[model samples]
Target: MTPQQYHVIALSSLGGAVAAGISDNDLGAISGYSLLSDNATLHAALWYPGSTSAIDLGTLGGVNSAVEWPNHALGEVVGISQTSQIDPLKEQWSCSYPAGSGFLPYTGQECRGFVSRFNRMRQLGTLGGNNSFATGSNIFGEVVGWAETSKRDPTCVAPQVLGFEAVRWGLEGDAHALPPLGQDPASAATAINDVGSVVGISGLCQNAVGALSAEHIVLWKDGIPHQLPTLGGSAWNTPMMLNDEGAVVGFSDRPGDNNGNNFNGHAFLWTSRNGTTDLGTLAGDAVSYAYSINNRNQIVGQSCTPGCASSRAFLYQHGTMYDLNTLLDSSSAGYSLIFANDISDEGTITGLAVSGAGSILAFRLVPNGGWSGSTMGASREGRSLPFRLRAGSFGRIMPNLTH
Candidate 1:
């Protein structure tokens, strides 16, 4: 199907001003997070194929929950949720974002990775620390993400004295820490395939975020961590998603970003055959990032123009990067599609979009086999991109270390 056959579908939030884009898709539903009406907390939510109202996946006895990845074949969802226990250190976990005008971290309550199925949620315990985050899962119910360990890492920033390690959880909810690269203090598993292969970042425990901490992109096969080459920088070499064919796609800093503080990396696709190939930005853009790669090897992400003053969503395939907005119908209203988070093998995509009224909203683009009568549109620049999916706020979204 051509992109012209695609149509936009807006999602509903839980009476809040913001609704993050869908992160995973099931046979008939999509999962993500939305702010609660109370405006202080968030809740994991699911939307049926055509329903406007979302089903709230209640939290694990706390104020927040998120669905980062859902195994559509198994009907299971994985993510992080807050608990009743308050964090003694009051550290802002990596998933935290600003709520409207007030910035809030997932503080106070201790959060943990979780698996939910049949409407029942089970927490995936940490590696002797207070928090965990689950990002991807396969049909086998095996989950991959990161968790805090008992060790107090010197590399970790203030209040976050405990280090974190990438973890794989069994169907029974047991945590298994993945091996790091050469005794590195921290690692995080972001995506896993049904074949039992997993990929993520191997880095220091600095701030528990992948930004400057990630030094290597790693793929684990048979429990052995193998280093994947970067575009030639020492930091921000992150792999955001991996497909079953062993193709990994993400973003990595170029050799010119050797300063160590820069995270402005170009999108990269790595394979056992090609090693690593830089996927350049859209026309007039300076940086790009890939968040998801389907089995067909089609990739989707965001590209920012020079100086990051403007951004656009992109779909890359067959060695060409096309602006997703450009693929929309030429007669449609102007909608700035900013960040493309994930694309299903069926050619459906979900991400953040700015409407004609300048309101930020999560949107889905479904490719139909035939044209549906809806007109097309043109792309407009100047809208801001978010650093993380914020509630009622628009900022620069960082390279998705948590996803």
Candidate 2:
């Protein structure tokens, strides 16, 4: 028997008519999204998450900015805002609003030279070097990423230089940079769990005068960096996301994987019980990269399959890997599932689906219930009626689309 069908709920329009005329715009071309409430109305997008539909978190005069959903929190989103058009320095914005409105600023101006708003984009400010980037945010609004600091050292021949370190940000205090691992020149914190653990990559500067292949996976707890041993490799090992239970997922290369210019990397999962477990690639393929992990320990990423046209999205659960396309309703045309960015505790997933126009559209997969059969038939059955999850709660039942 075929797996149960899942309904594709349109959460936002990234490039539709409502989003046109927005300069250099991509509407709901969501890179990441999180459901704040099962009600579906209360959620966060990587960009604007509101009714007007095209209101982006105004950038620092730059054409590009990113929005990410903050875990399970309602009405909160975080992203990087470029501060200037001439000298664009990425600043972190912690955006929050009343339970039902669009995002409004919640923090002061903190400039970090470069930033990547991934996972849960709460800004993790700089150590002392005037630069920081955020990767993830936990339920309490705490954030983890990396920062740069100014350092004076006798080993340095010239003036005092800047150094990079992992960092954590929370309501308890100012942003604090996690300590470095050994003599590695730079370290970055990528993802954080609800209990406050963090993970990322650490490595020496990659250049002629400072070139050294010393990258390793590092974990941080209470603002301290602890090196996580690699799968016997030299180039670099990067951790992407961590679940609430402290299980971390990422990718690493083997010793012989990269010789001269050839490179080979494999996805891996790490936990306290198991140091690191390799998540092999699809049939006859060579490389894989894991990006996100849900609370149920289900891993979502992309892998190259032999004879396949390109890398496709995949979900690994119960020790089995399945192509994400298998979950979609094949009867629907123009729907091409791509990366699965984040999944909620309820098994709902948010990711991008490419249309025939090559535009990326954000989608939310909810249980295939509510309305089924023909649109008019379901509406006549009162199936389009909105159901509230709590007593004294109210919701707007969207009009059934006549198709």
RMSD to true structure for each model, in Å: 4.2, 13.0
Find the candidate with the highest TM-score and give its number. 1
Residue-level lDDT tens digits of model 1 in 1-403: 3344556777777775556564656464677777666655667877767776767888888877876543433687777788888877665555553212212234467878888787678889989988888888887889998988888889887656788889999978888999899978789998897788999999888767655567889999988899999988878787888887989888888786764565568999999998899999887677888888888898998888644556788888889887777666544346777778787777788776767765556677876566455543344453565443422111234222222
Tens-digit lDDT track of model 2 for 297-316: 97766565321224545567
Measured against the true structure, the TM-scores of the candidates, in listed sequence, are 0.88, 0.67
Candidate 2 Cα errors over 4 Å, as ranges: 1-5, 10-55, 68-74, 85-124, 152-161, 207-214, 259-261, 305-309, 331-333, 367-403
Q: What is the lDDT of residue 172 in candidate 2?
A: 45
lDDT of 2 at 108: 31
The number of residue pairs in model 2 that clash at the backbone is 6
